[model samples]
Structures are given as C-alpha cells and as structure tokens.
Target: MIAITEGPINTQAVIDAVQADGAGAINVFIGTVRNQTQAKPVIQLDFEAYDSMAVKKMQEIANQAAERWPIQKVAIVHRKGTLQIGEAAVVIAVSTPHRKASFEACEYIIDTLKQVVPIWKKEKFEDGDVWVAAHP
Candidate 1:
C-alpha cells in the first residue's frame, strides 16, 4: 500500500498491510510533527504534495528496497494538509523473513522517500511560517 492522504495517518493499518505469514519481522517508522524547530516554537504544520507523483515515487522507493532486500511486503502512508504537534505525518512499514532485512528496508524506504517524494512541508511558527524540506 502506498498512499497520500489529507487526513490522519493510521499507523497500525500501515503495519497490518505489510503482515505476511512467512515474515518473522515487521519494522515500522513513524514521522511525527514536533512542537519546535531550531528553538522556534511551532504552532502547526501544513503539508502539500503532488499527490499522484508522490505516490508513484513512494512506490518506486518500495520497489527499490524490495530489490535490495528480501522484503515480503511494504506499506507507506503520508498525510498532507494541516497537522498539529504529535500527530503522525508519515508511516512506513516493512516485513521480511529476517529482522535485519526488515530494518534495512524500512530505513531505506523512509530515507529515500524524504529525498525523492514530492512533498513540501511548511512549518507554522508562532510569528510566521516557512517552507522546509519534506522531512527536515
């Protein structure tokens, strides 16, 4: 499953999507909105994405991880629109026969998604807002 939604991300659903009978390990990574950036208090965050391209890039990242590891299944769900502090912005889950592969693949998917996915994040500070990198 690869999706770009404007609502809250269901982290458990992402994990469940990757469950496999032969897989012994499932790794999940959740990216959350923080209350501050560089000591500046943040009121909220607004995320925007070229939805179709974002989903395509995410799927490509998943496929690449599958090539590098013995990944049984993978799910990546990212939320756009406004989000408050502590809300999950993204959830990535991967399952593999072994723990190491699951860990590696999960990490790879998130790292690559940040680099390649066409998602923009705007940090809404108390005084102003500034656009930042997707996962910065």
Candidate 2:
C-alpha cells in the first residue's frame, strides 16, 4: 500500500497491510508533527505534494528497498494538508523474514522518501511560517 491522503494516517492499517505469514519481523516508522522545531514553538504544519509524482517516487523507493532486502511487504502512507501537534505525517511499515532486514528496509524507505518525494512542508510557528527543505 502506497498512498497520499489529506486525512489522518492509520498506523495500524499500515502495519497490517505489510503483515505476512512468512514474515517474522515488522518494522514501522511514524513521523509526526511536533510542538517545536529548533527550540521555536510550532503552531501546526501544512503539507502539499504533487500527488501523482509523490506517489510514483514513493513506489520507486519501496521497489528499491525490496531489491535491497528480503522484504515480504511494504506500506508507505503520507498525510497532506494542515496537521496539529502529535498528528502523524507519514507512516512506513515493512515486513521481512528477519528483524535486521525489516529495520534496514523501513529506515531506507523513510529516508529515501524524504529525499525523493515531492512533498513540501510549511511549518507554522507562533511568529510566522516557513517552507522547510525536504532534507531539513
């Protein structure tokens, strides 16, 4: 499952999507909106994405991870639009035959998605708002 939605992300659903009888380990990574950044108070966050391109890039990341690891299944879900503190922005789940592969693949998926996906984030602060770079 690879998706971009405006609503809240269901982390359990993501984990469930990647579950398989052959898999022994499932790793999940959740990226959430925090209350502060660089010691600055955060009000909220607004996310925008070239939906089609973002999804394509995300799928590419998943495919690459599968090639690198013995991944049984993978799910990548990202949320767009305004999000309050503690709300999930992204959830990535990976299942593999072993724990090490699951961990490595999950980490690679999130890291690569952040680098390649065309998702823009605007952090709303108490003072103002600024568009942050994909890496930052």
Candidate 3:
C-alpha cells in the first residue's frame, strides 16, 4: 500500500497491514524531519510532490522489494505538505517468514524510494529555507 497524506501517519495501521499468519517478523523504518541539516538550524519542512509520479514510484519500490526478497507484504506511506521537526515523514514496513528477509526488504524499499521517488523537500530554517534532495 502507498499514500501521500497531510495528517500524521498511523504507525499501528502500517504494522497491522503487513502482518500475516506465516510471517515471523516485520521490519518498520520511520523517517523523521531533523532539527538541523548542513549545520543549519531547521525549524520545519515543506514537502511537495508530483502526486501521480510519487504514487507510481512508491508502488514500483514495493514491487521491486517483493521480487528481490521472500516477503509476504510491503507498505509505504509518505506525508506531503508542511511538517514540523520530529514529525514522521515516511514509514516503510515489510513482513516475511523470517527476520532477515523482512529487514532486507524494508531497507531496500526505503533506499530505492529515496533514490527514485519524485518527492521534494524544502528545509525551513530560522533565517531562510532551501529546497534539497529529499528522502535520500
């Protein structure tokens, strides 16, 4: 599953969606807005996306993870628009019959998503803001 939401993400919902009877482990990775970057004091962030491309890219990451690992499920949820420091920006969950597969697939999805997704992040600082490569 994939989505671009304005409100905060539900972590429990993500875990529940990926769990299965045969799965022995579920790995979850959460990305948060940091307080600082490049030595600048960050106050918040504004995330923007080409919604159509973002969703397609997210699904592609999930499909790639599934094919590369022996996993039962994959879920990726990313938030858009304005977000404050410490807010959850993205969540990736993967469940498999073993711990290793779950871990590997979860990491793969996040790595690939960062590289390929069309999400742009504007880092808001006390003095000024700048747009940089996001989710990578």
Q: Number of the top candidate by TM-score?
A: 2
lDDT of 1 by residue, 1-136 (tens): 9999988988888889999999999999999999998898999999999999999999899999999999999999999999999999999999999999999999988888998899999999868899996665
Error of 2 at 124 (Å): 0.4
How many residue pairs clash in model 2?
0
Ten residues in a row with the worst lDDT in model 2?
Answer: 127-136
Query: Which parts of model 2 are misplaced by more than 4 Å?
Result: none
TM-score of 3: 0.95
Ranking by lDDT: 2, 1, 3
If both were scored by TM-score, which would come out higher, candidate 2 or candidate 3? 2
Better of 1 and 3 by TM-score: 1
lDDT of each: 0.93, 0.95, 0.90
- Ordered from best to worst TM-score, the candidate numbers read 2, 1, 3
Give the clashing residue pairs of candidate 1, or none: none
Q: How well does candidate 2 match the true structure in TM-score terms?
A: 0.98
Model 2: per-residue lDDT, tens digit, 1-136?
Answer: 9999999999999999998999999999999999998999999999999999999999999999999999999999999999999999999999999999999999999988988899999999877899999874
Give per-residue CA lDDT, model 3, range 20-135, as digits (tens).
Answer: 99899999999999999978889999998888899999998898888889889888999999999899999989999999999899888888888889999999988898999765
- Give me the candidate number with maximum lDDT: 2
- What TM-score should be assigned to candidate 1? 0.97
Prediction 3 global C-alpha lDDT? 0.90
